[model samples]
Target chain A: MNEVMSLLKNHRSIRKYSDRPVGREQVEEIVAAAQMASSSSNVQAYSVIAVTEQAGKDKLAELCGNQGYISECPVFLVWCADLSRLKAAAERHLPAGAETYESSVENFIVATVDAALAAQNGAVAAESMGLGIVYIGGIRNRSQEVAELLSLPQLVYPVFGMCVGYPDQEPGLRPRLPLEAVLHWEGYDAERSESGVKAYDETMVKYLRERTGGMKDTPWSVLMAEKLAQPARLHMREFLQRRGFGLK
Target chain B: MNEVMSLLKNHRSIRKYSDRPVGREQVEEIVAAAQMASSSSNVQAYSVIAVTEQAGKDKLAELCGNQGYISECPVFLVWCADLSRLKAAAERHLPAGAETYESSVENFIVATVDAALAAQNGAVAAESMGLGIVYIGGIRNRSQEVAELLSLPQLVYPVFGMCVGYPDQEPGLRPRLPLEAVLHWEGYDAERSESGVKAYDETMVKYLRERTGGMKDTPWSVLMAEKLAQPARLHMREFLQRRGFGLK
Candidate 1:
């Protein structure tokens, strides 16, 4: 692997942070790099909010399922799929009779993809600078509350959050599905996935056992089974609808 | 900025590619780097189909709005939001009478986000190896046909496709929104976006005039206005539903 690939493969989500602060200049640099990520048709329908104040982070930490690292990190960034800016621009530029489809499901997907692409770039940029980062999906646990806390406008939803700071603790790299399991050639290969995942289940079994001191030796499939049987963020659909996003 | 940030910032969508072929080993390296990207709780709900055969590429190219570059590129990758693997795993591990939420809207978002994050990493890794990439959102233009062509299984849908090869043309970097326009401090700043976009409108006007030799001097916002007025891939919701993704 090359140096850039090494940086990418070395990624680990940091949940513990040192007291070192992330300078605003550093944040700006990271954001600038993120802004350059591919946007669908250059709509750039995303916005990031850097929460540095103690109270703001504290509230966000609570909102994000009380992930205290959000509070401990020097910066907690809320990555939002924002269509309001596009809506505003469309209103400004379109002829008076033009109806806008800014909130269509397709645009929603575009905005979400744009936000994720930008966030990943920012994550890589921060890692290159010795900064550690963790994505907080719990930002969506109470999406409505998070929106209220950040005073987000209609048609803008927080997709995820990232906690950035110097690493105080190192975490092991999580094993992913085998390359064959995820990468197919020419067309879909359903046969490959079954065996690859069966093998991966064994690998993950050993990993979980070692990581948890043999207390949690359940196979990865079982863990995944438990996860799948449980509903997560069921409010998401309703919340997006209320935010003026078109799903139908 | 460091080398990695420089690479990230230097990104421009490559629409044209030379005849140089991308080796299988190179694609593996890129996939390996992409596999290391963060997944939602390590669910890793995504897959990639690497289409290298000319016939396969031609079919996909037609499916993706006849983008000639899809056929010309050495490799056309279909990145998929996949829940089928997780569902299979759940079925294997769960006891009888257990229901899975694998097709929920939440899982749909997670899968889509996972696919996008991985694709971005793959793009960067490829770029590091002196390759170029262009994301094809048109993969969803005729998503059902695309899915049929790839023989995609239930709960597996192509989020986007990417063309990868050596650049045959030098496209100037498209200017992005001002950093302040996308970055807010502590909360969403609606006021800042207005002025920032106004300034960026002027910037984009000049860029479009120069890029098209004064043939298309339209402002970025106006282009966005037209985009918003046109419904794109309205079949996405239904297609995803047919593929067993639950939006409700």
Candidate 2:
């Protein structure tokens, strides 16, 4: 396998980080890499706020379901799906424009994809620099507060957060679905693909057992069932709507 | 600047690709890097189908608004926001379960984010390998046919497509919005961020004028207005709804 490929295959989420401060130069490079990501129609409807201040990071950690790493990491970045800039541009260019360019579901999708692409770029760049990063999606749990803390405009919403630093521990790569399960040749085959899921479940179970002392003994299927059975996950839609995304 | 940062800073969307096949090993590595991307709660609700066959690429290209590069590129990959696997997993684990899963908007978001994050990783990894790539959002222009062509099951939609190969031309680095335009200090600030747009518009106008001659001389704001003024983009919701994502 290629060296980069090996790094990718062995990648594990690093929640624990060394006590190191990421330099301004590295931060600029990471954000620049993020900006280079392809945008929908090149709109680039996303922005990232780097929170290096301990106070701001602590506040973000609180907003993101009290994830300790958010405050501990050398760099904390909030990836936002932003449309406010375009809205401002439109207003400045065409004062009579009646098209309410607030957060619509379509725009939300664009911004989210833009932010995700950029953040992924940043993550890859960080990894290449021998840094470890983990995405903090829990920021959406308290969307309103996050928006306030970040002072996001009406058309901007915090999609997620990420913590970057040197890894303090080496966690094993989490198992993924077998290629057959996820990859379809010509057309999608649900039944044909389910067979691959069985193998994936076994693989995951073995991985969990070996790594976490069999605490999560259930197969992948059962674990997913428990997750979906809850209603709290559905709260994100309401939060998005409240945050100005009329996902109509 | 780091080599990776330099590569990113110099990144350009390479629509014109050389007629060379991307090897299977490279494909696997890229896909593996994609899988390493963070997912919402580890759901990993997405899949990628590598299309190497010319006929298949032609069909996809036709379906995706007849983008010439889709057929021209040696390697084409369709990234699907997939929830069918989870639905099947649910059905297998809890037959006659009351809690329906497939027809939910939350699941769609999860799948889209998963697909986007993974595709971004794939893009960066491909870039790291000295390959050129471009994303095809035009795939969503004809979502139903794309779903049918990919044999996508209910609750599975094609979010986008990616074409990866060596570059045919060395395109310059595209300009982006100034950091101030997108990044908010605290809370949403429309008035404060407005100034940044002016600077960005000047930067982009100069870039457009220089890059593609005066023919493609539309300012970023004008291009965005044209995109939003049309109803063609609004059809995505209906298409997604028909594909079984009950956005209610």
Candidate 3:
């Protein structure tokens, strides 16, 4: 594989960061690369909030399940699925249709996908620059608080957060489901999927055992089964609705 | 910037592709890179379906609002926000809790984000290999039909499709919202956002006029205003619920 492909394949989440500060110029360049990502209908419905101040990082870290690395990392970014700008544009240029800009599930999906695409580009760019990065999805655990902390307006939701800085430690790449389990042919294949899952269970059982030094040697199936069965962020639907999304 | 950064910044939607076939080996490598992308809580709630047969592509293109390039591209891959495997895994390991794994909007968001991250990695890898790609969001316009065509199971929605091949055209990199418009410091800077939007509208007016060969010219605000005011896939809520998502 080439350098770019190698970069894509060797991704590992970084939770420990050195004291070295990430330059503002580097962050700008990375965000510029993120802006080049594809958007639904070119409606780049996403915004990123960069937090470098210790106070803000401290608050964000607390809000995001108290992830200390969020405060330790030199730069923390919150990627938001933002439709507020579109609403502003609509009101300014087409006042008659402003109210119609109310968010729907589809629009929410678009925004979420756009945010993820752009954020992934930012992650790749940061990693390519020899910086460490980790996605902070726990931010959703307190979505309302994170939004208030970020001063996000209606129609803008903090989808996830990221930490970027010089790596203080090296981590092994986390194993993923086998490609056969995740990639189908022209259609969904039930039998192939079942078999793939059985194989992947074995793979993950070994991986988790090794990664956790045999203290947590649970099979992947058991983990996912338990995780999926539990309600995650049960208040999310109401939270999104109150934030002017998916109400349609 | 390095090669990866350059590739990220120079991204352009490739709607035209040459007749050369994409090697299966090359695709597997690309997908291996894709599998390296981060997933929410390591759930990996997504899957990809690769369509290479002419007949399959034709049907997919038709399902995706008659996007001809989807059929013309040497490889078209559908990225799915899939929880079916999780459901299966849950059933096999915890049958009593299987039904509780029914989808919620938060889970849907996780799936969408996971799919986008994986798809972006695949796109970057494909571009690194001198191939081109364009994301097809229109697949959602007729999501049920598309799902049926792909034999997608419940809890597995086709989030988007991607067309990949050797590029037959070199389009200019599309203009994006100004960096200041999308990147906020600490929290959102409302004043800066308004000003940035004003500036970007001017930039997009020139870009749109030039890209369309002067046949049409409209400010970014105007286009976004009109598009955002209209209902897009208004039936999506019911559709998702029917597909075993957003039921919560």
Candidate 4:
């Protein structure tokens, strides 16, 4: 396999990082790579904040569910789905005009997609440079504090954060649902796909057992059931609303 | 710059593709690269259906807003946010008295992110292999038809489609919002970013003028205003609801 393909296939989330600093030049290159990603209608409705200052990183780490690695990583980047820039632009260009555009849920979708695309590019670029990184979606767990810490404006929300550094440890590639289970041919063949799921459950069970040092392995299905059988995620909508998304 | 980085930096959305066939090996490698992307809780809740059959591609192309490139490309991939596999696994593995976890908007977000991350990896891998690709978000414009065409079940919605093949011609890297506009340092500073927008709008005006044979030479701000002033995007929520993603 080629180097890029190898990097992609061998990618594993790195939660542990070596105590080394990432230079500004590398950070600039990664952000530039992110800027190069495709944007919807070239809206580019996103922004990234590079957090290398110790105090700032510490505050962000606390805000993001106390994920210690966020502070320890050589580079911590917070990706924002920012409609604020456009809002400001509109205000300037159409002064006294009633902000005609709707900041609806669809707009959030576009921003989220744009941010995610750029972050993916950043991750790929970092990997190519022999750096390890992990995404911290828990940043959304307490969106309000994140917004406060980052001084995010209305219509600007942090989608996620990423930590980049040299790896202190190597984690195995987690097994995924079988390709057959996920890949539907002409139409979605649910029944046919389900057959593959049973086998995946078995594969995951075995994989977990090996990884977890003989602990009783949990099936992927039960874990998903546990995840959804609660109301933990209900706070997300309210959180978004409080963050000024007005997700109408 | 390395070949992969060069390819990434120079990437343009290839709306037109050649009829050259992408081999099965390349498709598998690309899918593997995609599968390597980070997933929420390691639950890879996404799947790709590679459509090589011309008739299937034609139907999908028609369903996806008559995008001619979908059929023209040697490989058309429909990326789906899938929850059915987990649903089935839960039904079979959970205790007899246990309740099934009803799919929710959170699940949809997880699935969508998973799908997008994978598709991007595939895109990067394809670019490294000297292939070109473009994302067709219009797949959502006719979600029901796409679902029917792809045989998708209740919880498996088509998020996007991708067209992949060797490029018939190279398009230049489209101009982007200036770094100041898209990169927030410590907080969201609209005033500070405005200058970047001013610069970028000038750059885009020049780019459009040069690329489109002096057709109007509209600035980025103007194009954005025209785009947001319309309510065409409101249909997305209704479409998602119809696809069984109860956004509550």
Which model scores highest in TM-score? Answer: 1
Instruction: Give me the displacement of residue B222 in model 3, in angstroms.
Output: 0.5
For candidate 4, the lDDT comes to: 0.78
In model 2, the Cα lDDT at residue A95 comes to 64
Which residue pairs does candidate 2 place in steric collision?
Answer: A150-B187, A151-B186, A151-B187, A151-B188, A152-B187, A152-B188, A153-B188
Taking the tens digit of each residue's C-alpha lDDT, what string does model 1 give over B54-164? 999999899889899999999999999998888988788786989878767788889999999999999999999999999999999999998988999999999999999
Docking quality of model 1: it rates as high
Provide the TM-score for each candidate, comma-separated.
0.98, 0.93, 0.98, 0.94
Candidate 3 pairs with clashing backbones: none
Pick by lDDT: which candidate is best?
A: 1
**lDDT digits (tens) for residues A1-248 of candidate 3:** 69998898889999999878798998898899999999988889999999999999999999888889998999999999999988888888878535664667888888999999999999999999999889998889999988998899999999999999999998887777777888887888878877888888898888888888899878888888899888888778899988988556
As for model 4, its CA RMSD to the true structure in angstroms is 2.2
Pairs with backbone N, CA or C atoms under 3 Å apart (clashes), candidate 1: none
True contacts kept of 3: 0.84
* Winner of 2 and 4 under DockQ: 4
Candidate 4 second chain TM: 0.93
Task: In model 2, state the lDDT of residue B32.
Answer: 76
Candidate 2, residue A99: lDDT: 73
Give the runs in model 2 whose Cα sits over 4 Å from its true position: A1-3, A97-104, B101-104, B184-192
Model 2 misses residue B226 by how many Å? 2.8
Worst 10 residues of 1 chain B by lDDT: B99-108
Query: On residues A29-65, what C-alpha lDDT tens digit does candidate 2 reach at each position?
Result: 7777788889988888888787888899999899888
The local distance difference test score of model 3 is 0.88
